[model samples]
Target: MSEKKTINDAVSKRYEHGFVSDVAADTFAPGLNEDVIRRLSAVKNEPEFMLNWRLKAYRKWCTMKMKTWASLNIEPIDYQAISYYSAPKTQDGPKSLDEVDPELLRTYDRLGIPLYEQKMLAGVAVDAVFDSVSIATTFKDKLKEAGVIFCSFSEALQEHPELVEKYMGTVIPVGDNFFACLNSAVFTDGSFVYVPRGVKCPMELSTYFRINAANTGQFERTLIIAEPGASVSYLEGCTAPMRDENQLHAAVVELVALPDSNIKYSTVQNWYPGDENGKGGIYNFVTKRAVAHERAKVSWTQIETGSAITWKYPSVTLRGDDSVGEFYSVALTSNCQQADTGTKMIHLGKRTKSTIISKGISAMKGQNNYRGRVKVGPMAEGARNYTQCDSLLLSDTCGAHTFPYVDVANATAKVEHEASTSKIADEQLFYLGQRGIREEEAVSLVVNGFCREVFDQLPMEFAVEAQKLLEISLEDSIG
Candidate 1:
């Protein structure tokens, strides 16, 4: 085959995490009602207060409407037609890896996540959430030894009900928005973390979400709390099986950093993004936010290269004096994907500061947009914010956009915003090509360089994975 043919073949490769595992699952019937909420809560054996909270959120969702985002064209969703919950068939939660289903373990192994403690990555604790339940959590004993509670959301609710009740909806209220509200009512499973005062977590806590069963919407809720003088770094990864019909993944994440604490959250989302025709893939609508107290810091770094439609704004609220917030993102859209993702910084305390760096890459028929907001409250004297949004396009058929919103209530507050849109330069490509670099590899090199700034914020291992995902996503955009 010719060189161009080989490149074309590489570009048209199928989604790697697209195969479904053959495992028996107990799935709810397709529909939503108060009864469904009650059943879901009961299935997890949740506390009575949790049931009441879900009911309240469900009632609010009944009166709410689906929101429409600017410049995003999404098809109407039938909420009633989606199964609210699905889980691998089990009598009770697995107590150990041996008790877990073999097929599920193999499934995770295939995805490059080993749940076995001895086989998994060292210095990392993982809570593996498959479908609607957490199947395994590694390094639990070690985390408990250091007063760090890292486990599935369901486990947290059972083992630490007081902590869960105290901070569950404090940051992201039950009725935050349409998707988040929906998640509040029907969310099945996710990860939860709590670091005690004056203690820093010894290992990186992680959660890997896998959407397996068909016709089931994965609504997971994650909450992380760091006490005074505590610090932790958390990472999240997600994947889904490919099908002919679109699936919905609406998740809510809340983080709280107390005085002098620090929390860094990273995500490498590689959900199935359908074929060139946009027939399948995932509709990812997620809400992630963090609140930093006095002298605390919260950072968000995400590498998004999947999902047919991605709509999420990971935000931070600097609520105490001298708090800091940062957002670094690299979102890539390829083969008819559409992404409307960015971050929000709300400075509510004196002398608080924030930084936002967003890089958007569009290839083939992808449409990428960065919509961000920076707000400074009246009490935030001497607050500062800096935002930079840059977009890279690989083909003329794709488009990139930026919409930034800034509101400053204090004259002492200072904010700066910079944005640019550019395409792969022919001269640069020619230079790389003259050195015997193939067209596709040259394009990948340029894309990786453009995204290095954001990648630098990720963990060492994840940064390399992010680069490979970007290269694979840019396939077929070049001739």
Candidate 2:
């Protein structure tokens, strides 16, 4: 076989988590309005403050238009045609795995979730979300005993409304942007965490989202708070079943680090990408931001390799003197997928520091773009910022683009930026081919080396998974 054919054969694997559950679902009718917002809030039984906030966000979203500043060419979406909420027929949260539906449990097993009581990882707590509602939050008692508050957003609103109301939109305000506004207006379920002062989270906190019901938009909202002198690490993963019709997902995540605290967040997004021809998949638009108080720190690490169209920019704002922020990302798109992903850093306090490292891999006819921004305000004297963006192409037909914006108003501040774009060279492939190395293996070696810098920042569990995903995504494309 030719080298291209050999490479093609390796990359043509199907989406492994694309099997749907047959259980009946309760889904809200497709549409959006003030009434819909009111109904959703009522269903969640949120406090009055939350309802008023949602109304304000909805009103603002009504007057705004879809953001087209991105280099992506997205199809028109009918907001009224998307179901706002969908959940398994169960009317309440699962109190335990025994209370979960058999179908849902089976789905979890198929997706490789560690839900078994006996197999549970001792140090990790997970909040599992199916469709638009959280199904279960594991290790609640353990977390509570340690004075750590971890639960679903719904549970947080009902049990700790004060905390929810105080930190929910503090990092990314209600009127932040177009997608964020939509998420604030109709977000149904997500994860919430609060690390008390002077304590490090006993274990890693995590959330897994699975999209089941067809034609339903998954609008999840996540908020995390680390009080002064506290530290916590959080992980988020997501996947969806295969479908012929495209689905919309707009989510918002906010993080707040009080003085002398640290918060580290990581994501492994494997949302179902449409078929090779881009026939069906999810349009993932998300906004994630964090703020660091005096002498605090925040970090974000992500591995994105799925979704037909993915738009996300995880950002950090250094608002306190000597605070620190860091972002490390690896985004890969294959088989007609489109991804525009990166991060932003805002320096507003004296001596604040930030670092960014991004890697993009494009295969088949996919298009990948790295867009980032760094700003140093007038008062941010002695601030320091560094950025690195790199792109790798597996096919001649693929494209990679970069756009970096740096604004410095203080002469005392210093900023450095660097970018590189390269493709798999024929000579390199030939040398490998001559050395008895197969095409697929050669590609994997080259790609992995290119991504080693970013992968080094990922948690051990996700690093292996990301490498496997990269192999699968590029297997057939280079052929």
Candidate 3:
């Protein structure tokens, strides 16, 4: 009905991997043990306090069990069969663009990330994590100028021990969930960001993650803290080369927005999805959340179009009066892919408000589900929430579902939810065909329109690239 939708209808084509490279990998052997964890920590040169923290997490994880409650039917994961760490051996750490590896820069260029270290050296900052280690971090001095701390988690633990000790596992406790516990124990590398009180980050903070080693699992943990009156926007990108064996990728991300502070986190995940038969792909199980302290706000926007099995739910807790939480997501599951993803909003403060918008596209035997919850505590007077979830199935072999749980203890709370499932109409494609657009291009346009609502929330540069990635990834199923 809308002009944007018309354009999206033309862009609903299926996708496939565009660029495959022949880069060599530097890796550790497959396995998990105290020795492995210790080796990883030693490689990072972590402080004693941090090593003890990791050891504690490892002990807790050893006693935990793997989660098996989702509708997915995945094979049992073998921890010992996965390499805990990997990196590219060709590149030594570079302080500037000229000193960086040309091959590495080419890879980012193919992935469509703007990796001009000069621009970053001039203003923007980046933490580029390849496999298990952070290769380089740009614009460190500039961020420090504004009292912002942006560096790898390992570096943060050593340079800012007090800050790391105080905030680590504070938002998402170590025992929060199964995968989270695993991440706490063995996460090899991730970014850490802290914005000082009353200071807005002068430039955007971002991390680009790539999985290069075969049989290696990627477990990265990201923690961000915004002090009172501080503001920051963070972006993350993921990509892995094509492989037959399913690789495990479990990650945890936590954000804490203190009083009067605001944090916006965005992600564009393009992991390698298996072929139509589901033979080889990544199993992406992630837990991400944010807590908005009194009078604070946090927003999460994600575009997911990868993985053979994806199970994720990014949630927010509103503990501050008048604080707000928002989630916008576009998830696509094609071929034999399965995705069970959504969000949760817990209203604990007066006048707290939350919004959720989820769009799912399923094609060729794909299965998609949106499971979410909105809870208004007894003391949350005048709380409000709104949710919208829609699914588009490209063929009869695909399926879509929605499960929403609303718990309202206060009578004054306002809650609303709407869900629908539909398929692209033949007439719509025919209309586009009549206008001289090819069938594939027409399909891409339509699907893009369907996802505009969520894509619009992405940064300007990422939004355009995500749209193109969606179009390329769905190329095979459009017809």
Best by TM-score: 1
Number of colliding residue pairs in model 1:
0
For model 3, what is the error of residue 218's alpha carbon versus the real structure, in angstroms, after optimal superposition?
0.8
Q: Could you say which candidate leads in lDDT?
A: 1
* Alpha carbon lDDT of each predicted model: 0.91, 0.89, 0.83
Q: Write the per-residue lDDT of candidate 1 for residues 283-377, one digit (tens) a residue.
A: 99999999999999999999998899999999999999999999999998878899999999999999999999999988778899999999999
Tens digits of per-residue lDDT, candidate 2, 289-399, equal 999999999999988888999999999999999999999988888888999988889999999999999999888788999999999999999999999999987777788
Stretches > 4 Å off in candidate 1: 1-13, 473-479
What C-alpha lDDT does candidate 3 achieve relative to the native structure? 0.83
Tens-digit lDDT string for candidate 3 (6-117): 4334323333343455556668889888998898888777778777877888888888897776778788989999998886665454556666567777777776554676
By lDDT, is 1 or 3 better? 1
Q: Native-vs-model 2 lDDT?
A: 0.89
Model 2 misplaced stretches (Cα beyond 4 Å)? 431-436, 473-479
The TM-scores, one per candidate, come to: 0.97, 0.96, 0.92
Candidate 3 regions exceeding 4 Å error are 1-26, 90-93, 97-99, 119-124, 472-479
- Write down the TM-score for model 3: 0.92
The order by descending lDDT is 1, 2, 3
Q: List the residue pairs that clash in candidate 1.
A: none
